[model samples]
Structure formats: structure tokens, C-alpha cells
Target chain A: MEAPERLGEVVQASTDRFTAQCYRLYGAPPLGSLVRAGEREPHVYGIVSSVTTSSLDPTRPVVARGASEPTEEAIYRSNPQLERLLRTDFEAMTVGHTQDGTIHQYLAPLPPHIHAFVFRCTPDEVRAFTQRLDFLPLLVGARTPPGDEVLAACLREAASAHDQPTEFLVQAGRKLALLLGGEMQRLNTILRRLPL
Target chain B: MTGREESPEVLGPQLLGVVVGGSLSQGLEVRLEDGGVVEELKVGTFVTIRGERHRFFGMVTDLGLASADPRLPSALPDTTNPAIVRILSGTSAYATMQVTPSLVVGGEETSLLLEGPQPARSIPFHFSRAYRASQEDVQAVFGAEDERHIWIGSPLDMEDTRVCLDLAEFVKRSNGVFGKSGTGKSFLTRILLAGILQRDVAVNLVFDMHSEYGWEGGSEEGHAVKGLKQLFGSRVAVFSLDEESSRRRGLSPDYLVRIGYDQIEPQDIETLAEMLNLTQNAAQATYKLASRHGQQWLREFLALEGREELAALADQLGEHQQTIESLRRRLDRLNRMAFLVERSPEDSVRRILEYLDRGTHVVLEFGRYGSDLSAYLLVANLLTRRIHDSYVRRKEQSLGDRAKEPRPLVITIEEAHRFLNPQVAGLTIFGTIAREMRKYNVTLLVVDQRPSGIDEEVLSQVGTRITCLLDNERDIEAVLTGASGARELRQVLARLEPKQQALIFGHALPMPVVVRTREYGPRTYAEFGFREQAELAREAEKDLKDLFG
Candidate 1:
């Protein structure tokens, strides 16, 4: 099998979430995308919840310099040193972990170690991981500010990995309706955002 | 309209759901499966539950919509979106049906085959799967068409599956056919009578008040419907009280029934007192005059024209003068009836008894007299009294010899409440037969629209009650009296279609069933083995020639 492409390295970790810093500037995976850390057993999986591009060091605040340039690309092209000062990183809520070749759609026993390699999951891996919807409640109950939107986007992203995306979204929407019982407003918002 | 081909899979019974909670008295509550659409499941339809130890059969009496959360109604989902509607239907909101389990067959196939179905005394275990009853389940419960079973109709939505009646058990006791006017009560009664004659379980003596059961009757659509005589040929004998009226209807009645003044006993007066508007004292005075004037009391009394002669006779009999005067006034109406002669040459009661004794079913058509309730009450009371007496004497003589026991007689009476009301139910012979309940090998098939007017005691004794749509609360209550699970059956009974549908429950069927009553057209006529009139005449002529040659 081909090796999954590496995207970042885990810079900060916790029992329920982890922060991964991209190797290249502005190279963070899109929000709500599935990504995992660790190259061997006990792979930790999560959904990308948010992304940031800021100074590598907290004390050094980067200043904007594109006002005098004719175009934004020209400003970036003129400032080669800016790439060394800025870094892109994303925060993902830990949704599941794998052990013994069996995927467990729940919190890992221990957080991923810092500096562990993180890779964006392949379409086949995404489909296999989402074969069962047990991990839906984790995404729905996340502490993210726009939790329903994040959950909807994650479903849309996972749906494309399946042969029949509409059927997959409908199944996921029904499960959300059940989990969000009496929360019709939340369910309606999520269903409206579904690709179907 | 949708080009939907009705495949067997779609028409056949599909899995409904599981029995969630219920009791034997209130019926089981079934939570519908996701595939079961609530609108598709109708009330009064048949359902079968596969319990662990038994296969329970029942009717869907009620339907409901429920949700896992009580706030679903106020917090409604987006219904315009088909995806949202589909998703929220079965998961967050679900449908439920209340099933009244009536009969249960055993778990083992061998046991079910040997023992048949029995009343469901206990409920199925929780979560037992309930389904739309299949044709095989219906056949298993209500046996196949055979010598002893008659196909009465098909259950609602199960047009291809026949729900039969046990003819042998049906004739064992008096049954009733009740509904509001114009609800096909007459047609349903005809079907039952035809079935009884076809099965030969018992011989029926019908007092056809409307002249419908003797020859042909017109349906609501003005179509001619055949009567029992036309269907049964030689097995049925038609007796008409109005020969001219029968002839006008193209009927050749076998016998003309004429009641004599002497045959009009004082008891017959008591039965007709309500219909004739006779006062209690006026009705009671007939007995005094009968004892004083002897066998020709009615004829002798009607001869007293002037008030002075009546007063003198009333004083002689020690009755009040005014009471005698009013009694004479009421008895005078009988003189206008052409069927009531001064003295009849032939005994109509004895003729009817002879026909009944020979296993020939008799239908006495009242013809034009059917409009006059008093004439009907008098003749029916007189003839039934004598026939019942003879049956009692014969039944006693054949106590040990079953073969000699008189054939079971089911007397069909229309406008039955007039004879079976509380005032005269005890005094009338029809009421006596209903109460005695086949003791003398005689039963009644009481057909009426106003069951509430019938004596409650008599109504309770009716074995099987097949009723059409009855909007009157009292009538529905009266028909459901003394029935087990009457509360659930009340809902089913009230919802019956105004025509060509009936709720049949009681001694004849294993469970209560709502049926689209079998069509009473050419198909049913063929089923009853009816031959053309010319063919019957030809056969009769052939028999006569062979006998002489």
C-alpha cells in the first residue's frame, strides 16, 4: 500500500484534542477534514475544528506589509524572511483512536505524544472509519463554538468518500435528529447545511 | 393513477412492528417499524402477532402518533424537506396501533392443526412482532370453505382472503343482523339465510315482511336481487299472505296463508297491543270475551254492532262497558284485512309446520300487509306459537333418539323489536324462543334496525350479532351488550361503512372481524347453486313424466 501523505507534527496534545503545526507555511489542512497522528499502532484520529496563521514565537507579532505592493503575491514574494517568522497550525478535537487494527470511535487512553507525525486520512481510510456512525455524538457534543456547522462539514467531507454520498448524508442527518432530540433548531440548522 | 403495479409483495401482509406494552383488557400497543407508514394502517383491519408460544390474531381497533420526546409537537422539524421528513419520522416520531388480540393458535404447527384457534386470554410477551394478517393466517383462523364453514365475507383490505362463518355453530342459537335503515341490512340477512340453506345446518322459517325473501327484491340501485326461493329451488317454499301483491311482483307463491278469526287468540292481541294503540284494559278485555264466547270469540264479538248490545255483553262478562267498546273498536281493524277471514278453510300454522318438518325452508311474505305492523304481529305470533308448541312436544318424545330429534329451526323475523320489546318480549312466542335458546331445537334470527328497542334480556341472549353501521349510540350499545372486549369493539362497530360492511363477533366466529360483506350479485348466486327458472320447470316436468310412465 502507498504511504499516507504527512501534513504536520503534533505540537500540543490533550486527552480530547491536539494542536498540529504544519511543516510549511500556510499548509494546514482545511477545517473539518479528518487527520490522524502516529505512524504505527494506537493512531489518534480527529476532525480539524479550527486553523491559525501567526508568529512562531508569541513575543514576535508579525506586521502587515502588503499595502504598498501592487498585488498580495508580490508582497509575499518580496518578504522571504516572513515565512521563517509565521507558521500555520490547526486544532482538531480527538474523536477516536485505533488499536489492534480495530478502530475505536472514542477518546484515546492517552493523548498523542508531542512531535508525532500527523497525516490527512485517505478517502478509503475515511470511508472505513465512518462505516459506523458511533463517532457522531463526539463531533456533535464538541466544545467548538460552531459545533453544528463543524459536524455538518465533517459529514459532507466524509460523505464524498462513500460511493453514494446522498444516502450517507441522509443516514447521518437522521442520527443527528435522534441525538439532538428536542433541539429542533440545532437539528434544522445542521440538516440545512447537508449536501443533500 | 401512479402506474403502480400491485405486486404480491406490496399487497401481502408486511411486518408492522413489535408489541411494546399492553394488557389483555385494553389490547396490546404496537410501535410501528420504520417501513410501516401510519397512514397506510387503517382502523378495523386484521393483524397477527407472532408470540413466542402462540400466534395471536386480532383487529386494529385504534391508531396513534407518539414521540420519544414529548416536546416534538411544539419543536416541529422542517417538513417541507423530504430528507428532514424522512429522517424524523420513525426515529424521533413513530406510529402506534392498538391491537385487541382475540384468538391464538399454538406454537407448534401440529398443535395448531389439531386444536385450532382459541380465545386469547393472555397477552403476547412484550416486543412480539405484529404483522398485517396474511391470507394463510386468515385461513388458519376462519377455516377454509367446506361443508361446515360458509364464506361470509373478506376482512377489510384483505379482499382475496375469505373470512368464513362456522355454519354449525351459527345456527345453534339465535343470531341478529342490525343496522340503521338503508345500510344493506336486508342484503346481509339474505346472505346469512342463503348460507344456512346451502350448508343444511338448519331449516329457516323467515317472516319476510318486505316481500323480498320470497321472490326478487330491488337493491338500492334499483337492480333486481334474487330471493331464497329462486336460489334454493325445491328446498324453499314461499307462502304469501297477499297473493295479488305476490303475483304483481311476478312471484308464484306455493301457499296462500289466511288467518281465521278463531286463530286470532287473545295472546296475539297482547303482542299487537302496542302496534294497534290498544289500551291495557282494552287488550285485557279480549281474554274475558274469549273465555265467555268460546272458540269463535273474535267473530262473535265483532258481530255486536250497537253500544247497548256491547254494554249488555260487557256486563254479562263482568268487564267494563268502555273497555269492551274500545276492544271492539280495535278488533274491528282486523275485519278490513282480507287475509283474516271469518273462518279459514286451511290451517296456515299446520301447513308451515308440515313444510318445516320435511326440511323445506319456509319464507312467509307479508306482501302489502308488510306496511301494517299489526297484521304482521298477529299472524307471526299465531303461527310461531303453534310451531313452537309442536317442536316442544316432538323434542320431548325424541329425548333419547337423536335421529328423531326435530331438525333445528331458525325462524327469521324482521322488524323484530316490535315483537321483542320489553312490554311484550315475555308475552310473545318470539321472545320465548330467544330466551329458551334452542331447548326445543328452535332458534331465532332477529333482523332489525332498532336493536335498542328490543328487550335487553333478549338482546343479551343473541348468540352472534353481525351489525352494519349504526350511528345511534343506544343501538350500538345494545348490540355490544354482554360481549367480551366490548369497549374496543365499540370503536370498530361504529366505524363500519354505511353499506356492504359488518362487524361479526360472538359465538359463530373465533374473533371479532370487520368484513367487506360478500357481494350479493351473480357471483354469490352461482356460489349458492342457483339454477335458472326454466331449468327448474323442465326438471319438474321430467320428474312428473317419469313417475307416470
Candidate 2:
């Protein structure tokens, strides 16, 4: 109810699609994990496809030089200034929108407004939305070549997000296997790379 | 509109799923609603998706039930336990269905036809709710009550829903019932016959090859099916090729119609050639025999018994003398046949035709002739030739009066593929009837196990095809090819349960439908309104007795 601690903010918006930049804090929502944005009447839904960590100010040249420290953690701990230079941002692909307590598993008539709050979808919301694997094709057939890996990551994140995530993950994995049944090698790659 | 009893609730059946996305041509995929379990929906179930302005009806082809998460292990996890089932109930569970949109109803102007909505043409509003097709929607889609609707069976989806075929359209075109052995093709045929008799739209002449359709027939489960003659006593006349045997078996045939040796036409022998395994040279000898002896080919050919005399005629005809001699031996077998009149029976063929002409159905019982392919083909071809020819002439000659007109005729034959094969299609009278049946007001209800054996042209011309389960790919292809509903029907045809289920398609109904074939046991027979006509005959007799008194 208290905005669930904003994970990110919408960076761009289109008619039915939008991209959000996550906060430079904990690891961003895994690929395929659903994230929510927008407010009031139309709440936009997206599936994370990518995560990036880069200098917040692109004009500034921030580089990590090899320090003579025993461990990498010590080097990072000693040079705390490096942490403030860059930020972690996750990108989500629009899959659907929900409004007035009704879920629409299709592109929204309007996208999330720019700078709208981005938050990880609640376990209850994920449970309600993923009742059917109808949206798998959108992630699997994404124009990007690494869509499969992204789908695998998002699926694992979704599995762990719920209390009974194991059974859900196993069933979801079986479905994923079925969808990719024709491509044994690709299916195996996704199964092997799954976060679970 | 709302207050009247005639205008019931317009809302379709209960909500089942919502369209997520899918290609239009192949079909669309629907995601189940909350608490909607995949197991609740069966294959062949019909669902409706509301479009912007129209309602799209779809038949479930494939069901999708899996984990929504790809990261789950590839090996299927055991979900047999209640805990697993509870786990399986939530959103991570993937439950979807592949549905082929078959009909579009509920627009500004409503019309129903065979054509389906074009794929990717008018896509359903994405995410719109797809409901379990309501009673009203089904009534609108398959209502044949106004037509001569023959209640054939209940749909496999719902038990109480009667799937009726428009008997008027069914009789107008040649139809076929095909299935593997023990798939209840005979039961479906019997039920269809009952409908025809009940409607009295057409006079049927069934060439009962198995003797299973006249008085009482052997059914799939070896139980008895009270035949058409029993249901329509006065309206249905039973004739037997082997009347003595029929009587021996206690079958009281209406007429013991026998065919003489003279009635065996060259073409009849020619049609039987393939079944009899006759050589090309031996088959050609029948033509030579016919050419030399106009009306007495079989008798005269058998009379030339001497090897030398046969050799001389064979040499003159440029055929093998031994082949011709063996042909004599084969023709000799018919001499011992009790049904084969050495001297022609006095106009037996005409007597059967007279029965049909009087608007009475005829079921020609074959008795012992049922198993003898040579005898079956020989007698069937000979009798059908005369009947079809006279009917053709009468149909062509008739001018105007409707009441006195020759009734539309339906000739049903079992093991039809053997007679309708490509080798004999051009020659058999059944083939000619199959082709021009509509014009001659004659159609065939061909029953066979191997539809692939029948000529493609004849198969294509069949009007309504009610097919039970068949495993043979060729048989499946044969029934599906050239049908308007072939593409989507493939799914329906594939899903028919082995026992009493069937797919009914073609001219008889608006769309192809999967049916759990109607009940036809003796106990249920009286309830199907089959005895009303027999009761009428009883009433008529009582009237005559009263008048005479």
C-alpha cells in the first residue's frame, strides 16, 4: 500500500510499451519476472528482459583500477567512491495492463507515464496473472536473441516469489519444456540456466 | 424484449477462458480464468469468444496444461498429491486451450453458413472472455427443429444436448457411414434408417448384405437391433434372395425375390471380377460370351463344356483356352446356387421395384448370400441396374403432379467399398446411382469399414458422412478429403471415442459436429417413436374390420 518501496521508474513511454530504469540497490528483478508501474486508472505490467549496471552520468569517465588488495571485496570496500559512480537499471518488456480490479493480458491502450513508479509484482498478483502460460510466446519470441535466457531468469524469479514456488516452478518448467519441446538444445539451455 | 418468455437470457454459456493470442487460421489460444482448472474442459468442447460486434464460436482442438515458469525443471513434477494439486491450482500453473473458431454469430444481421471467420482477418478482441457456449448459442448454431430434424445423437460435450441432422438435406444427397469393425457403424445406420422412416421423406431400399437390418439385426455387442421392417411393418417390405433359408431361419420375408441366370449381366460379372479375382483374359471372355449369346451369356458359356469346343471359341476370340475353360468351371458354381434361378423367376426385380414405387421401403435380406462376395455382387448389381434404370426414366419423364410423383429413393448397401472401387466404379450400377443420384431422386447410404477402397469420385460425391473411429490413415484421408469442413474436421475426426462416438459432417447439418451416437438397444427402440407407424397399420386393420362388420 505504501508503494512497496519503488524498485525503479519509467524512463520512456509509448502507446502500449514502456521501459523503466531500476534503482541502483539490490540486484534488479530477474529477467521474465513481472514488474508493475503506472498508477490511478491504468496500471501497466511488464516482464523484465534485461538488467544493466553503468555510470549514472555517462559524461563522467568512471573506471575501476586494479588495487593492490588481498580480496576483490576489500578493494571494493576500500574504494567506496566507486559505488556512487554507477547504478543498476533493469528493463522490462510490456506484456499487459490491469485496471479497475480486472486484468487484461494484452497491451494497454496507454503506456506507463514517464517517470512512473516501478515495483516488483506482488506474489498474489503473480499467482493470479500466471494462471495460464499464454504469455510465454511474447518473451520467448522476443526480437532479442537472448529472450530465452531472459524468460528463464524471469520464470525462476516468479517461482521463488510465491510461497509454494517449487511446485509452481516445476509445473512452469514442464510447460516451458513443452513449448520448447521441438528445440531440445534450446530447452536444455533454458532449463540449465534457470534461477531455481 | 426483456420481459417476454420467448426472449430468454441473451448471455451465452458460463465464462470459461479469455482469448490471449493465437493465429486466426490455425486457431486461437485461450487462458483459463481464476479457479478454472484445465481438467474441467475436455477436448472437443465448444467455447465462444465475444468479439467487438460478433460472437466467435470455437471447438477445442488441443489443451495446454503446464508450468507457467520455464525455469522449472524439464522433468514433469508429480502433482498427484492434494498439496501438489493445491500448488497446481494457482497462477504459476499454465492452463490454456487451442480452439479453432468455426462459426461467427450475433451481429447486426445474423446468418449461419459453413464458412468460418478468416484467420487474422477479424481477430477477436484480445483478452476478451470466452465462455462455455450457452444453450442459446448452441440452439442458434445447431437448431434443426424446423427442418425434418432427425435427432441422431447427443454431443460428446453435453449429454442432454441432442445433435440433430436435417433429414431433408440428408436425403437429398448420397451419404455414407464408415468406421472400423465394432465401431457401431451399423447402429448409426439403423438409427439413421429409423429417422428416414419416421420422416418418410424418402423411400429406402437397403441391400442388407449381412441380414442384420431386416427383421432383427446382429449388433456390435452381438445384441439384437430390431430392424426397420419391425418398426415400419406395413411401410417397410422385406425380400430375401434365399427365401428358403430365410424361412428356415424363421425370417418371414415379404417376398422371396430370386434372380435367374439370364439376369446375370456381363457388366454384373465384370463388377464382380475384382472380388472374384478373375484374370484379365477370363474377364474379357465374359464380354465375348455376351456378344455371341445376347441374353443367355452365363448359361451358354457354361454349356460349352468341352475342352475342344471351348478351345475353338477361345482361339477365335484370341483368349487362353484353359482360362475360358476355368471360367466355365467358375460359372458352373452358380448353377448349384439355390437363389440363382436356372430358369428366371417371374419378374422378381419388377416386384421389388413395385414395392419401392408404392412409397414403401425395401430391405433385401441376403441370408447365406451375405458372406459370398460373388453372389452378393452378382445379385446386388443385377437388381440395382433394373431399379435405377426405371427410376431414372420415371424421374426424367415425370411432368407436374406432386402427390402422385415417384418418391425420392435411398439405396443403402454395406461393404460398399468393394462395389464402388475404382476398378468397378465405371461399370457398377451403384456407381452410376452414386453419381446422378440427386437428379434421379436416388441417393445411397453406403456403409463400409474401408472407405479408402471406394472410388475417390464416389467418396467425394457422398453428401453427409457419419464416420466412427478408424485407425487406418488412408480410410481417414478418404473420408476427410474434398469435404468443405476437411481442415477443422480433421481434429474432430481424430478425437472420436472408439466405441459409440462419431463425427457427422457434410450436407446434413450446418457444421461438422462430434456426437456420442444415440442409443439403439431393443429397450430404447420403442421409445424412439419407431413403433408409431406399426401402430398405425394396426389401427388401419381395425378400421377395415369395423367397416366390413
> RMSD, each candidate, Å?
4.2, 9.6
iRMSD, per candidate, in listed order: 7.9, 13.0
Model 1 chain B: ten consecutive residues of lowest lDDT = B1-10
Cα lDDT of all candidates, in order?
0.88, 0.76
The clash count of every prediction, one per candidate, is 0, 9
Tell me which residue pairs clash in candidate 2.
Answer: A31-A154, A32-A154, A33-A154, A130-B91, A171-B67, A172-B67, A172-B68, A172-B69, B13-B134
CAPRI class assigned to model 1:
acceptable
Candidate 2 iRMSD, 1 decimal: 13.0
What's the lDDT for residue B482 in model 1?
96
Off by over 4 Å in 2: A1-196, B1-12, B34-36, B66-93, B110-123, B144-147, B399-405, B485-488, B532-549
Chain A alone, TM-score per model: 0.97, 0.78
Q: What is the TM-score of chain A in candidate 1?
A: 0.97
lDDT against true structure, model 2 = 0.76
DockQ of each: 0.38, 0.04
